[model samples]
Target chain A: MTPDPHRAHVPAVVHLDHVTRRFGDVVALDDVSLAVGPGELVGLLGPNGAGKSTLLSLVAGLRRPDAGTVRLLGGDPRDPRSRTGLGVTPQETGLPATLRVQEVVDFVGGHFPDPVPTPELLDQLGLGELARRQTGALSGGQKRRLAVALALVGRPRVLLLDEPTTGLDVGARQALWDAIREYHGAGGTVLLTSHYLEEVQALAERVVVVDRGAVRADDTLDAVLRRVSLRRVVLTAVEDLAGRPGVVRAEGAGDGTPARQTLYTPDADALVRDLVTTGVEFHDLEIRGASLEEAFAEMVAPEGAAR
Target chain B: MTAPTTAPTTPPATAPPLPAARLAWLHLRYQVLETVRVPIAVLGNLLFPALAMFFFVVPQREVAGDPVVATTAVAGLALFAVCSASLFTYGLGVAEDRQLPFDPFVRSLPVGAAPQLLARIGTGAAFAVLGVLPLVAIGAFLTEASVTLVRLVAGVGTLVLASVPFVLLGMAVGYSLSAKAALPVVQVLLFPLAFAGGLFLPPQLFPAWLDAVSQATPTRAARDLLVQALTGEPGSAWAWPVLTGWIALLAVLAVVAYRRDEGRRFR
Candidate 1:
């Protein structure tokens, strides 16, 4: 049951067909297939060791799959020629320790036929001031920013960013997202992976949730979120309401008058109606749509799906 | 994904990458920059041979006062300098870089490993030559080693040629072992090779049986050739064959080690 089965017809910049990869007896990727069409910003959402990095390695030609073929820009990924237009920021940042920031940028850019000018690229990534500083002297966040800048320096047609902002603070993460958005704005194809569901929810037009080395759900962001029907209802009330109508699960604060409670249900509308009609006096009632957290959980653990 | 506003376009046929030689030169330039910034690392290669020359050769009148003896000793130590520099520079230097995340990213670049690898060789050679300068200065200034201009140039060329097999050997070790293990291995190999090759002790001092055995080793063969280049006297006929044999053998081992490393990391 593959999503976008006709994806091959569109001439994908990156395409993997039934690829399987293993380490010793451990299967890293199992019969997985996917494609990224030109100019699409696809988010690969998965938890740690879900084979997200493994998939990128296959496309980047750093590793070969035990089965099936992978193509980059219509050429075999292993061929250096095929990778000329691709830029990648792997999960770990590794700039030469003694090389200055600008030198690192210049060195990487030199490999490409048409590269972004060093000064402009550094300034865009907020690294202009650090150009003369050695990479080893930079803070962790600064090194990460430089890594992303190196990925962009080559003016590549495709960018593959693995866990691009996993450990970044909110502000840093947002800034990187904006940089990615700018690239997307210019029609650069991006295939980024993240374990943070909110990261996918924030930037991805399409979400591909990967778990246990297989595709769990691959669809438009709205469509994936729509699968989540369990709305959250929070209120403070005097009565016990664990088994209220339309509520599938409920938790309450330790026994107290006017205790706080949260109810999860399929229909907040009917639940609110039942609460009012039943003469339950509750204050501070709040209703919100189902979170991507629960939606992702359902996708990964199908039998427990609320819908 | 936000549906594209402009039409989706496939990447054009890839442009011709930077010329391979130019890329290799650029790689060498940065590699040199990286090494130059670390003064101590370069100093290690330079100081050891110079210290040996100063303490052992300069103080010994019989070895340093006689022209032929002094010149051969200088040549042998120069070869030792090249050998030591090649081993540690490639063996430990490569192993250390392997520990860094940057090494793999460089390996993944589209220009392929040739440019980077060639540049590493150039960097190692540059520093190996730098390592020799102090020893040369100490021998020239403090001792009576003398050579014609032709022989002087020949000795330099021979020293570079003699470094090849050791560089290959270092690469094999570098690729095959982690940094922690590689350091001890390179040290253990370096000291013994230098001693057995008669680089420290004169070949004539070696017992006949030991001298024969020494001639078979790359280090001894390299030392003998270096001595011949400087003294204009021929060494045992085994020099070229022994050196050539080690070069061929280590060359294969180096290639095997490189491929094995690639397979282990990427496959």
Candidate 2:
């Protein structure tokens, strides 16, 4: 396939080529290859231990892949210079308890060539009111906000956040999402990992679902959402519904007073038409699109069942 | 949706990379600030050696009255100070840091590890020097520990040089173990080393076999060198070589431990 001319000039902000990482004998990442172009906001969605953190760690230069290459900002991720324009907040960050919030921001900022001023960065994160407070004194949500503030202090062109809002309350999560949106709106590339499907749905233009150390799907948010758009048809039926046309699976009582059955299908309308044509008596029909949670579960189900 | 798409808010004017020395200094400043905020830690590090002097040497009239003996005794305590600071600062401190998530964040920064390590050494040295002051005052006041300006300067220099092995050893322990294990390990290692090295009693009082074995340890070499610098008394022929050997060995061990820890934790 020819490279699209319009995209040829913009190098990928992150490139992982058949990368594999292992801890002892356990594979944390299995030959995962991904490329995120500049200005793309990609969400890495996965359950715990599904290699989300491992991927971010590789990009952040905190760990090396056992095989293949990881390039950040067009250079080897392991090099300090390669990470100079990158920022990361790991899943959990403990700030120095004795240092005031502002001092921590300044200290981290000092390492960058051009850093956002501490006050302005803190203000953006809604942490200005607590800038002078010792980090240990702040609530968990506040600490999380401060950690994110530190990540942005360098005015990084690419940001990698691993479960950035894991401990945050709803209000705090919203605020952090707003801040992240503003950054992405300003053309910053963001690759964030999250177990919260809603968070990813709200922020990511592209979604990569990872399961069992591999990417199950990587596409635009709408594409991924559509991939899991299967409908559930619930009804009471006297007939054996398992082999019905268009039904992926059906489970419930085949015979009972108002016999209950739930059939899963890619096309609920076609399945309903088939039931009608076959003259299968049914009642209490309900058809609904799968929730993102169900889509995520269905996506990761094979790995779960294999284990 | 057509927001003015000006060139992505240009980053603030890029400042030149801070010099390594300046970065190291900033780390030193923060390290000192963090430690000092806990007054008890500072007091504990400073008071132990001084208290040891007050109880051990001041009451021994014959030893205190003799300039050479008193100077050597004070020098031994000073060596003890440096050893304690090195052991606790790097040993316990490093292990504690390893448990904190903040450490990984700092380690991942673009500035590399040089500044952090140098800052650690600087902080340890500062504390070591500070911890010795009370012992020095006690020696000068309660005993006849007389030394020329040159001897005093050389003595201080010797104390710092002697701390290298202990500092590296502390780092080795810290990086290889958890905070809970490291604390007890440092405690277990420190006292035995101090006692065998003649910090508590003179090497002349050691049994023949004990004295022979003591000469092989870094602590003993440090104590011997400190006494030599303070009293102008010659140390054993093996002192410098033994110290150098221990420094080399500990340096290798420290590097291995650090790399192993990094591999295990970050990887």
TM-score of chain B of each: 0.89, 0.88
Query: Which regions of candidate 2 fall more than 4 Å away from where they truly are?
Result: A1-10, A90-93, A234-263, A278-289, A303-307, B1-18, B207-209, B263-267
Itemize residue pairs with steric clashes in candidate 1: A205-B1, A206-B1
Best by DockQ: 2
Put down candidate 1 lDDT per residue, B1-267, tens digits, no spaces. Answer: 122221223447465567779899989998888877888888888898899888889999998999999988888888888988899888987887777777656655677655666676777777777788887788788899988889887887888788888888998899898888999999999999999999888888999898888989999998888888889888989999999999999878876776556423433
Give, for candidate 2 chain B, the lowest lDDT window spanning 10 residues: B1-10
Native-interface RMSD of candidate 1? 5.0
DockQ of each: 0.27, 0.32
Give per-residue lDDT, candidate 2, residue B138.
91
Q: Where does candidate 1 chain A have its weakest 10-residue lDDT segment? A: A298-307
Tell me the tens digit of each residue's lDDT in model 1 across A187-302: 88889999887888788888887888898878887776665557888899988787788776676743658888878777899999999998988999999876767645655763
Docking class of 2: acceptable
lDDT of 2 by residue, A41-102 (tens): 99999999999988987887777788999988787766667776777773345788888888
* Residue B109 in model 1: lDDT: 64
Model 2 clashing residue pairs (backbone): none
- TM-score of model 1's chain A: 0.79
